[model samples]
Target: MAGIVIVGAGECGTRAAFAARDAGYDGAILLIAGEAGLPYDRTKLTKPIVPGEAPFGGLSALRKPICHANQLDAAGITLLAGTPVGKVNSDARQVTLTDGRVFGYDRLLLAVGATARRLACRGGDRALGFRTIDHAQTVFAKARGKVVIAGAGLIGLELAAVLSGQGAEVTLVEAEALPLSRTVPAGLAERLMARHQAEGVRLLCGSEIEKVTPGFVTLSNGKRLPAPSLIAAIGVVPNTTLGAMAGAMIDNGICVDAQMRTSVPGIYAAGDCANVTLPNGQRVRSETWRCAMAQGIVAGQVMAGQTASYDDPNWLWSDQYDLTVQVVGQVADRPDALRQLPEAELQFSIDSDGALIGVAGIGRAAAMTKDIILAQRLIRAGAKVTARALSDPAIDLKSLLRTQGDV
Candidate 1:
């Protein structure tokens, strides 16, 4: 049977298969993956890998397979693991695997995801790129001494926090003046930087890696640091080769519409491999798990002839040391206005129409959790709220919503 063929059996691909089944499409569903094992949560690779711990370890760990064999069988999902697709023939609706196998598809979903970007400095190969579970394991096994990390983005900072927690001295290098300069507000970034410094993670902002040697890394700022282990969490490049080769439009990622439909009609793209157009005609790709899952589900629903569109605001969270940092919506672009809730350790970005457009918080887990949920609601609804109400911890967000009849 010519079935729905999905490439890249990560969160997006697996979820798309399940979503298609759940939406009542019972035809043959083929899930293809380059990795050997079942689909696991890629987000958990940065977390502390604790062996034998429940939920976070063993089969229940985020690193463990999210989709088991029995589950796949029960769902009637056929999985081809450890097999990479070499090219996609959009016109013929066929996929060619690296091992010379070919599969025809009525509809195709490209969820190939992304790979970590590597640095080009001398001896850069000595530094490992932290993206996969294997990379995490290798770093954990070799993290006995001082470790230097390139880039001060989420991955770099997260690894720093995890390694430092395990008693390894960590140093983070970033060419930007502040860590997460493009994602979080300056105030929140400052707080995070302070938290890392307090926990003994050295920050080398506005510094570049001049050269990397077997035993050390020299900074452009003329500082030489000991580096028993060097890691690069620079960024990621979307895996758009197959889609591009198949004649799908490619920009920052595989360009897709709100329905996750690619330039090619029978083809769709989701997850990290898909770049979605926003309400303002802006094309962007969200590499977060939440965005990927949403896109995949929507793509599946659309493929099943159901009405669906992915319009959720961008959301992502990071657990660094004792702090749980959550950011939602577009805070990178300067908002029309900004408000700070110092007591609550929160910042809200207001658009020109006085709508809550973004929120960033770093504090006690429970409090931040509550604030994040409320912030998401307000941002999603585009609620026009006063800065005073948002800045006051005494005022409950629910009450404000009720007062405005937005609930």
Candidate 2:
């Protein structure tokens, strides 16, 4: 009998499989994961897993990575580990594995996810990208060496914290004017700069590298920075090879509708592999753990015939230099209208059409909650909330729903 098949056993694949079973899909559920061991949290790959030591335990060493798999197995889901799909004959509703095994399915879900982007240089062998546990382990082994990271983004910054804590001299190189300048405002970047500088991380902003040589990366300014190891946390590209091969519409990622349905019939895509539309009419592909699991469950339920959509306030968090940064909603196209609450807590809010569209919180969890509640209120009202209302001191976060009427 034909069964439900899911590719890529990352967060998305695992979440979808479990959600499907929870929705009472009694048929056979087949999951294909390319990696060994059960699915664990990918965010922990760059950070120290145990949180206080260098060369810390790996993700495979985690005891709770496979809880979703256990739940799915109990629900009769067939999980295929160490086996990756080589081809997808979508017309025949079948998938060909690397080992020449073929499986037919009634419905297929593509949550194949993405891998870390590799460096573009001659000494590519020495350049590393953070993605899986093995990559972290390889990096942790050389934590004591002088390390130069290619990008000053979240992954690089996080790794800088871990390495610097363990007594490694870290230098971060960014082509942009500031660290994480693409996504974060200059003010926030300055705050991060202060935090990392205090933690003994060197930042080389607005700098370009001419080439990466053996044990050294030549800067564009003709300075050859010597380092024992190099890491590339530049970015990640979606795993759309299989989806494109199957004739699915691809534009940086698998294009999906509001319901997480792919272009092809009987197929759905979600997580980092799919482009999702927000309530504010923006299309984005979130690589965060929250988006992956949320969209995965949405895709799973929709594929199981429960019929739900994947539209929630976008949220992501990054841990760097002992600071917990929380960001919610998509930032608008405007820059001049961004506002901040105060200096002590470090909170920023950017609105679209007078409605709160983006919010960022640093140092305090309460700051994040305020922004979340503000965004939630704006979304619930389907209109803009007055800036005065947001800045009011009497506004209670836990009772925010009262602003929109009783829950």
Candidate 3:
């Protein structure tokens, strides 16, 4: 029926199928997946499993689809799993599989997502990446012994927490002077660093590895550490081959408008692989799970002839040990207002026009999530707030949200 055809079966693509149905897209929806079995929730991989429990238990996402089989069946979305797409034939408005099958589409969405970026060092090959379900299975299945993880990013820290809790000696290697230097504020970063150290995690920030041998890693400083296992949590690169082949403008990722529309007609990109062009023409690509799901919904609705845009502020959170870190919008080094709550410390950024621009906080999830969400509403409403007001616990944040008229 040449309905909406979505490529990639991650959260972004899977959600798009449902969003299309909800948006009144009754046409045939085809979701193509590169991995076999049900599409899994990658978040489950970080959880520590009990002894003697099947490794697959940690891979519940791999075993269970985003939606139950019955739900997918009821939606009538055709799922083509475990097939490699040979090419995205834009001119023909078709997708060709490696097995020589073709499917035409009235509209096409590219949610191909990103892959784990590799280490460029000499012994980087000895390290296994932490991205897919198989990678998670291979890693946590036998997470004993000493493991050396490269990169002190969110992924690395989370893995270290899990392994340390499971009784594995872990050493984290990072080239940066501080962990999460790129995204996290110095104040919040310090708090997390102290927590990691308190939990007995060895920090080797501002260091590099000269080389890695079997069961050992030699540092550039000439120190050697036992590394019976190696993991790479460096980062991820956008999977942009298909979109680039289809002639979509590429910057850091496949460029798309706020509506998730690519330069090419009948083609759109979303999720981690989609770079959104702001009104100022700046290209911003978000790698957060929420951003992916939001972009997917926008693409689905827009493709279904509904009105929508990806206007939500970028938000993401990470859990390590007993700590939970959350950031919304774009947090800067210096903030316009700062607030210290009983359970969380928040930094708020306001624009020259007195509109809320960003917010960052680290604390107990119960105390901070609602406020972070409230701050996002403030940002959206262009609400004006005072540092004194933000500092007071008696003043409910929702008060500001309700009082602020859209500027």
Give the per-residue lDDT digits (tens) of candidate 3, residues 49-86.
54544322332213334877778889888888899777
For model 2, the superposed segments whose C-alpha errors exceed 4 Å read: 49-69, 277-281, 332-353, 366-383, 398-400
| Candidate 1 lDDT by residue in tens digits, 296-329 | 8998888877899888888888889778778888
Error of 2 at 309 (Å): 0.6
Model 2 Cα RMSD, 1 decimal = 3.0
Cα lDDT of all candidates, in order? 0.84, 0.76, 0.84
Candidate 2 residue-wise lDDT at 89: 89
lDDT of 2 by residue, 1-407 (tens): 57789998888888898888887788888889898778778877765545455543322222237456557667888888898899998999999999999999888999999878877766655787688877877777665668898889888898888788777789999989888776665667788888998988899988866788888999879899987788888888999988888888998899887788888998888999898765557788888888899898988788788978877767778877657776666553233233344422323354556655565656655445555565555554544455555555455444444555654
Candidate no. 2 TM-score: 0.90
Q: Give the TM-score of candidate 1.
A: 0.93
On a 0 to 100 scale, what is the lDDT of residue 38 in model 1? 87
Model 1, runs deviating above 4 Å? 51-62, 332-344, 403-407
Query: How many collisions per candidate?
Result: 0, 0, 2
- Badly placed stretches (over 4 Å) of model 3 are 51-64
